[model samples]
Target: MKLLARLRRAFGASRAAPDGPAPAQDLRLRRAAIPVMAQGTNAWPALHALPIEMLPVVDRPLIHYAVTEALSAGIEELVFIVDRGKRALDEQLDLEVDMLPRGVRAHFVRHNAAQGVGQALLAARHLLDDEACAVLLPGQVTEARPTVLAQLVAQFQRTPGSIFAVEPATPQMTMGSEGLLETAAGDLRLASIRRVATSLDHRPPADARLWSPVGRCILTRAVFDNLEQMADAQSPHTGDLRDVIEAVLRTEPAFSYRYSGRCFDCASPLRWLEANLVQALEHPQLAGEFQHLLRQTAQFVPVNEDLSQAQARALPTGAAAVTGRPRLRLVRS
Candidate 1:
């Protein structure tokens, strides 16, 4: 009963009532800030080989997925924070979206040099105009059926504080993650967050799963105010936005909405290949044509092999998926 009451207060307040989100214009007027600048490390050399957002995923550019998903969630304005040399992404955007959704607008904020995610976001502060905004990391691609982006936006409309989308992290998938969430006793709403560190042996109670922030958030002006203060103070982890979020949890009350779905970190080679294969296998238009091929590839190799080194390189370039090429199985475990 307490849980029911808590949920009612969160979602059934007079503003939200008993039905859907507040209104279309409430979401349409809001903006989404996507930070795209990343120092490409050799661990994943493909990022440096092409504009990270232009990297092919399921035969489509990565940014296409981000933009489409944002549009689906009713966010009409997008601010892309990019580094100086990364203007190539802007060109791709121009050529890709033939027509912007009714009132949607796309703008770019360029960083003079390579900096951390926090700085990239800070660069887009002018575009925010002191309103609440959504922050989406351009590197991760989520393929949830109902689209978790919509869920995050809905929560923001109802509660309107700093809300982040988090999913349970397996032991093996915890490397290089944003942060883990500590939820209230029996609820998934965030109570605290632990930032990623070089070394740590901490473990969560069995009732609580280690939840990683997947670069999707609804942050209010208060959070932005804190970000400005941190940017001015030159705080550590200011370069990484997750750390900035950790700093927010110190004084502000932030919440987490659990997403039990697939989210791939395309910046990672293994996950990137897996994301392509999974998304391709499920593509509505291409799935039937490629089903046999992908299934065959899944059986050809052991699940543990490093497909990134041997198989991913030998696969046909973007041309194959875009046009046509010799058939080959593409699979990931």
Candidate 2:
């Protein structure tokens, strides 16, 4: 295991040129507008009370994961779609204002009422301006590679249509949800977004492609139009993006890209635990420090182990066990 770790480190240390072709002369396809949907009414107060700015999957905040994903995907501007009374979110943004990347502008849209996700997106329509495409992320932590967003962006650029980030849903995973998908001409179509309460009288086609939409999507400005049409067409549902996407899928040629990563629904305690574990394992830097701390905690006296007994003693104060156990708490006198 140690040898494998050393080999992995050696390979990671060797840098490679950036992916994709040289920058086009125009250097601009369509400026990406990212809108992070964060509704105050639905947010768990306890989760909200926890410093979301400091809430880490591994050591990075949940919001940071989404923002970083967008920025890495060449998104030019970010607009956070929040609801009124969400002062916590505002404070978080202020606290991390200095950490924002240079040249990337940030904006916020606060909906006056607890509207639907479509309404929240509609609230930020002014920010869209002439942006041909936009990326919308549900403000929650998910385990995905940085290239996940990049891949979606590339697909959008090539197709100039709405793209949804999805994962293949097996029978085990689709227990509580409908798994009906239709494919034609290499494009995946969402047939229905039904609940378990509804009877599945219409089963999916035998050769139907199976994909479950994660809460992230790359959409064209047409989404804004769709939202408006949806609002006028039906009553709002406290910012449910699923409804909006369903409406759009009926009218537009929505495509799906199968993302290869685990996703965490951090709104629940169970999912949050899963997120932390997955992130800790995937984060290279954190894993390295953790392994080193474990060796010290075990009193491994090797030539390469630089920490003295005194230093090792202090390391336990902050280190969690490798066996998925919580850190030992020391009550102060």
Clashing pairs in 2: 116-239, 117-239
lDDT of each: 0.69, 0.59
lDDT of 2 by residue, 204-320 (tens): 556455566666776666777767877887755443345556655666677767765667767656677788876776677787766555555555444564444333444556674
Worst 10 residues of 2 by lDDT: 190-199
Cα deviation at 221, candidate 1, in Å, is 0.8
Clashes of 1: 0
TM-score of each: 0.74, 0.67
- Superposed by TM-score, candidate 2 places the C-alpha of residue 48 at a distance from the truth, in angstroms, of 7.6
Q: Pick the candidate with the highest TM-score.
A: 1
